[model samples]
Target: MGGSRHVATSSTHPGDLHIPGSHRFYCTAPCLSWRGGVGMRGSVPPPLIPVSPSSLLQPEPLLLAPSGTSRPAGSHRALRGSLERESFKPSSQPEEPKHNRRQPSPCPRSVVEAAKAHPTFGELFQFATPVLMWDQHFSPETWNRLKERHVPYGWQGLSHAAVSSTLRLLNASANRHLFDRRRFPGGCVRCAVVGNGGILNGSRQGEAIDAHDLVFRLNGAVIRGFEEDVGTKISFYGFTVNTMKNSLIAYEEYGFTQIPQAEDLKYIFIPSDVRDYIMLRSAIQGSPVPEGSDKGDEPRKYFGPEASAEKFKLLHPDFLHYLTARFLRSELLNMQYGHLYMPSTGALMLLTALHTCDQVSAYGFITANYEQFSDHYYEVEKKPLVFYANHDMLLEAELWRSLHQAGIMELYQRFQLENALHSAITPQPKRLAPGQDKWEESLAWRRNGLN
Candidate 1:
């Protein structure tokens, strides 16, 4: 912090600075009206300041929730950017191919269409009564010893340079078409996935946070309220259709409109259900559904026909196996989500990009003091991370912490040597909170088959 040449605006403020021996430059935009050092205490944080007046206070952005509107494009710019980077021009001087491998043929429309129509849930999971093929493919011994499995993949005692190089190759091929030219000329593409954990609430990382070629966000990503802290730009928004819809429904009062939209933003679908798969395909093809149907009447407007099968990239199943074997083991995976199997949706998406990008950074993810903050950094109202039937958030927090400590990624944190203006204010329970009685009701509903 002290090594940079400070660009001072006023006697009390600094404008910009160049760090010695570093490519990174820091800037400080100061306004006379700006009240610096607002603490994260009793008062609720405001939604992100609107980047453009046109984007302010519109109806919650509707997404194609099957029964509802589809989320607009530019939701997953970061992922698209990374994908574009992946599809970039192959290096001018091709290095020795990794092992001996032929270029894979372009996936056929029939295969792509079949996958589009496939039952997403069944494709990803199955009940263990007889144990599905995908579930049984892994040996229990391999499950019992994650570290041992890490050895066979290139991950055993992998160096940063080695990991970086492998990811670069993936990016160059996957995103070669998206970028007219590479950012670094010859440099590897970089991506940063920013979570919306409350740890970013008070952290002043706006400018520094946006330096990556791409940025990713997930559920409850309240940008307006946390703009000063998390920055105003969003490159990608990843979520299962249900999760995205749920967050918008759950956090509507806090200004959780559909994740921000940009002209170049690409919505990356994490297929979780049959409806999501159908809707995403419809969105890409620009097919108009009957207006009087239960779905919506209007032609879906969130995405244009520009999104075609060729441009979409699905996560490779092997990549998910690789992540589970290396970083997320029994202790963390089981603790976070029950059943020591499969990657969490967000984890799967992030790790997919990590395996494909040259460099990766994580933001708003679980930080050390997570329990002391709300579930999301952009929470309109402070709400603790509740354990729902859906997923194990706490265990995920632990995994994120472990990954951060291992230096495999970065987490946003604020430094305040003295008394901070505000502290994290805990949320008080509301009467008959939605989550409080849902589990028991859910059990009854399931027994009656009403769900």
Candidate 2:
């Protein structure tokens, strides 16, 4: 970081930050309600979401049986994003997006002080007892105990063999921290978690995104023709097996025909369904999927044939539970539809970065003005963002907004030029809560010092 460079603040809101002289930086912000299409849990399914197989979610409704009864056919899988379209023809390359933005040198960030300054971070951090589950943590006792809980926390309906085998194979790799601290040695390691929000459509943030030490991308991350906006580098790709396949099927027409593959790129599996464990096992063994919805599916088609266990990571169910319980505890959890709730894939990845990286920037994620743009920036046609019953995206938005205000993370938000300029010229300062004043005062100090 250059001494001359100073932290910038958004005139419209205290949470959003603008890097002085930098190409607008931050990654991911799209909370699509694909969860509405997920099979309802702990009860009967809801009315269909009017989605087709071609949609991002295939819509398989699950019906859980009584404690003593045999599980329903669909009960085996925790999630229902399995059905995919047969006409999955890849779309012609989308028109190449254009860019004229220049990137400034990197600005440093630290989550330590920022998280401490936050009102709820201490409480939330307590729940992160174990963020990633590796072989060393797996045991018959652990499995039996976890099995008592529901999905994303326990393996209730999943196979003991499948779970054990997967954990065993993760003996050495994919079970530890995301990256080596030795890589940065003694510096603030910055990360960018890119999303599929429409805000990044023309943001021209590609260069700035690649500037981070690590970049995380999730579901339907269409990058081919949009490199000018989302960047080409992917140090990590986060998704469930369902999402990876679903994105390929549902987004092929948008030019996302394949998942990103590289020798160094690691895959983070959320373990949302049995398909993820099965697929991960197969991928690590260099074999075809043996059973389940993706039976016979060749791992080579996705991960390169040489891909090893070192290239995959399985997020701990404990972490997922902690995130839901502590951070984005949506109201839907109390409803009949609550069982279907899970944080969007993007939310999971961004949170993962926050815990692992010194600093995180969320790009293309949902903002207050989400209605102003389509669901996805790369959609050939403009499709309004759908609010499905499966995910309470609005709640996630509040968390992101608060995290921004707390200075725990930087979420790049775009306001209309006229409005931004207007706010800049005639600011209407809101009554902030206690401790929030520190954020504003800190920004002011930096801005004044830079001047």
Candidate 3:
């Protein structure tokens, strides 16, 4: 299998580097315009603290379940037994009839009211409705819109037959479990979006994070030793096919031997590549990956034996586009990184929770004080967080801070919660100016072979 690669070249301008393979560049020249020719001559942001090459984690060799080996029957029974134990047991006091139970409202009134009060919040609601999932059959328009704006690596020349086959498989699956009032009894659903930032270390927020009705975790979510701080419950695991595979290879030493598995847990597949669609189909059907980079791979190894269509959800490509255009739009887009640019998995999962849940608390997310924490809580030694060209961490940090001040969500800011909140709301017209420098530094690190 041939994988895609990005090659960078130095340009005449300082901090300007060209990625020929992806046709993207890092523009540092003051006169250069970005994103619709907007002048970016303001002060450049500070450089990201770089980690030595030896400090960076290396991914292990790719491994999959042997082609013909089936998931052991004992594991299935164990999962089934665990589900039965966790199943909701109704109260003895009289149960509401199925018809009488409160059904989920088509549009949540609280969310609407909140949006009306905050223009930024309202804009997000308009762009991406929380109630719907971007499945192949249920959202053709969304799927098409996504295909036009987002190009997954190695999928530029994907055949029409391949697309159709994947969609056909997805169309046959069941719908996702959106916010249902019937399940919660009360109208509100609380959620926690947990990023794997090292700030979570010693935060002792496990009980708080797990208390929410649902919890969303992504990429290298290590829980074994850090349970007291990061929580043990994982209701949803969100990732692109690339991130999931990369995490397994890179963070396997950190205990992410396989994707999170539970009878009721759902996997949100961000369709960054055709491989995601192919893998999702194989997982649901209990078959080996039919073709592509993951050909002959068994899905049951990641998701247990009884994996079903109900356990998988695909993010609509349109929704991702909307997120980038409206909220996390970074200068990187004009640099030609649009094809590779997508919100960090943490950002996507948090936004999903915000749109769907009545109340949300974010744990281990990026804040102004991110430098104080390690790159990830699971690291044996403290490692400085490194910024990469593919993501706009500062933009995300600003958004999270703003959301917290607006009473939209509670971002766990560790010891600097109050300070972070204050700075988020403070008017700083020159904030982005200083932040732009970080991207340049990130590019420098990549050029130095530190990716």
TM-score top scorer: 2
Could you estimate the TM-score for every candidate?
0.49, 0.71, 0.67
Q: Kindly report which residue stretches of model 3 are placed more than 4 angstroms away from their true locations once superposed.
A: 1-112, 127-147, 152-156, 171-179, 416-451
lDDT string for model 1 (1-451, tens) is: 2332422211111111223333222221101111243211111111111110000001111111121222233322222222211111111110112342212213232122222243321122111111001212234442333222221121223333322322232332323232223454644455677776666778877777687767777666677767778887666666654455445555666787655566656455543333333444455456753221115521244444354433333332233343443333222121211121233456755664443444556776654445556666665566664332123343455444434443445555543333233444544322122222221222222223211
Error of 1 at 323 (Å): 2.9
After superposition, the stretches of candidate 1 with alpha carbons farther than 4 Å from their true spots are 1-186, 288-299, 304-311, 329-343, 414-451
The candidate, 1 or 2, that scores higher on lDDT is: 2
Alpha carbon lDDT at 50, candidate 1: 14
Clash count for candidate 2 is 10
lDDT of 2: 0.64
Candidate 1 vs. true structure, TM-score? 0.49
Candidate 3 positional error at 32, Å = 31
Please, what is the whole-model Cα lDDT of each candidate in the order they appear? 0.39, 0.64, 0.58
State each model's C-alpha RMSD to the native.
22.5, 17.6, 18.2
Estimate, for each residue in 228-308, the C-alpha lDDT of model 2 and write its tens digit: 999998999998775676577567778988888988898898887777888999999999999986789999889898988
